[model samples]
Target: MTIDTLDIAASPMPATVPKRSFLQEVIEDTPGSDPRFEMCIQCGTCGGSCPSGPDMEYSPRRIFAMIKADMREEVLKSNTFWYCVSCYYCMARCPQQVHITDLMYTLKRKAVREGYCRKSTASDAPDFSEFFADAVLKYGRSFELGLATRYHLRHHPLGAIKMATGMGLEMMRKGRMDLTPRRIKNVDQLQAILSKAEEIARQEREQGGVA
Candidate 1:
């Protein structure tokens, strides 16, 4: 659906509605707070660079337009956020110096907040995104295999059993996966940083409600 299909007006600042665009908040929340959207010259450079553009419901260019139009709900609910592979092609090719990858990540954070995420199935582990976030929050580093196993156990108990049966013997033989997580020496410091960052983001989100 196009941004015009929505009842929202196409304006940077919506005077009638006390609403915040998801795009605007994303731009604001990113580290260094790059004005990625501000520099778009409508050259379609980002769209050309995006490998997944053809499959997307809205191209990167369209998303930018929608964001500028303050179509917050549409942007958040769309599958466009999940489709980004973080390739950074758009970021690298952008003539305007827009941090496209960072914007994609911001949209992902919004997707999580809006409960737009897909649940794990019987054969699948929990969302790797959640596990990744947890790892960052807890250890300030990613423990990929550990997080994957934990995610599987937490979200797909049956799958975990199957996985263990299938790979447990091999893992034991090779000593590839560890049951216990290796702790970082300065975990508290890492947690503190993550906690503060999360708090700031939460505040920004609260301030910038759906438009």
Candidate 2:
């Protein structure tokens, strides 16, 4: 992991401008969040603090090392960032105060935009997130039955049918899974808030303050 001894290789991602290193690209990609990826010391602290580290294709610490190595293909296609639960334990415990959680978000965006998420083992993460977000925006509350039905149908049609006939029916019988979604009391207010946030984000992107 020593910079002097490490062998540098061409990144799978396209080079740009004066040619930015993968590390610099990551830092730039997460603008405003200020992910201090360069400050990583290979202490293994982030990996140790991560609850999902064991399930990741690469641990957080290793992902950092790979990032510095300019292993764009490997890093972006990894399950490390996708499996992150955003619990913030890793970020809080890092001596360098690397924004581990925020960095994961940055990486997730890169993975999705670059089409790497589709090639990843944790590819379902994005689909699940999209379903959840859609539910929230439409109903102002999570519709578990709809979420499960849609997710299962898209990923596992057979499982979806089985669930609808079996576990799903039981959940509905017990009132755990409602057949319909419920709107919040003030849906317009929520929409206004979300719209304002999106507007600010759009402005930030125009200013190169967000990527």
Candidate 3:
């Protein structure tokens, strides 16, 4: 009846859950196409090829490094994505074809949503983008006048008056500006599609999964 029990220290430990890095989180949260952020090789090509490189707080590769290090707050607070002109030059030049531009766009949306964009000098870009998106959701098309009016008035009241009087009048006179937004045909259908897309995005964000 001599039964010896195995030592607890020698026994297998329970499986420990591994924490995900910011890079993995970004890849998971990226919708539509798979993000190749993990493919980044620390090359300086992306940084050198950016047209607005000088304006950014961090180069794309450096940002990728930060993401790898799980520096979510630092990455989101950076003006790097805002300065990305979306010219695609960096993506074009990268030997890895790492979806640089798309990643930048994703970061932009994430930063704005998380309220990290307010401390940025380029924060107005997010506000204007929101106004433009609201107009599209409302009319199934952009209302340039309304968008500009709302954005400028909120950011620069004096400049808004000047812009309304100056270039705004000229554009209206030239028939390039309209008093109202023209609704696209089958606008309800468009809205439904857009709403569905939004629903998918929300689900992806919440689940931290890719589309």
lDDT, candidates in the order shown? 0.71, 0.87, 0.86
lDDT of 2: 0.87
Using lDDT as the measure, the top candidate is 2
Model 2, 35-117: lDDT tens per residue?
Answer: 77889999999999889889998999999999998999999998889899999999889999998888898899889878999
Candidate 2, superposed: residue stretches over 4 Å from native: 1-21, 28-34
Q: Report the Cα lDDT for residue 201, model 2.
A: 79
lDDT string for model 1 (59-168, tens) is: 88888888888787677666665777889898888988888778777776666666554431111212677787787777667776677677888877898888878886
Best by TM-score: 3
TM-score for each model: 0.68, 0.77, 0.85
What TM-score should be assigned to candidate 2?
Answer: 0.77
**Superior candidate under lDDT, 1 versus 2:** 2
The true-structure Cα RMSD of candidate 3 reads: 5.0
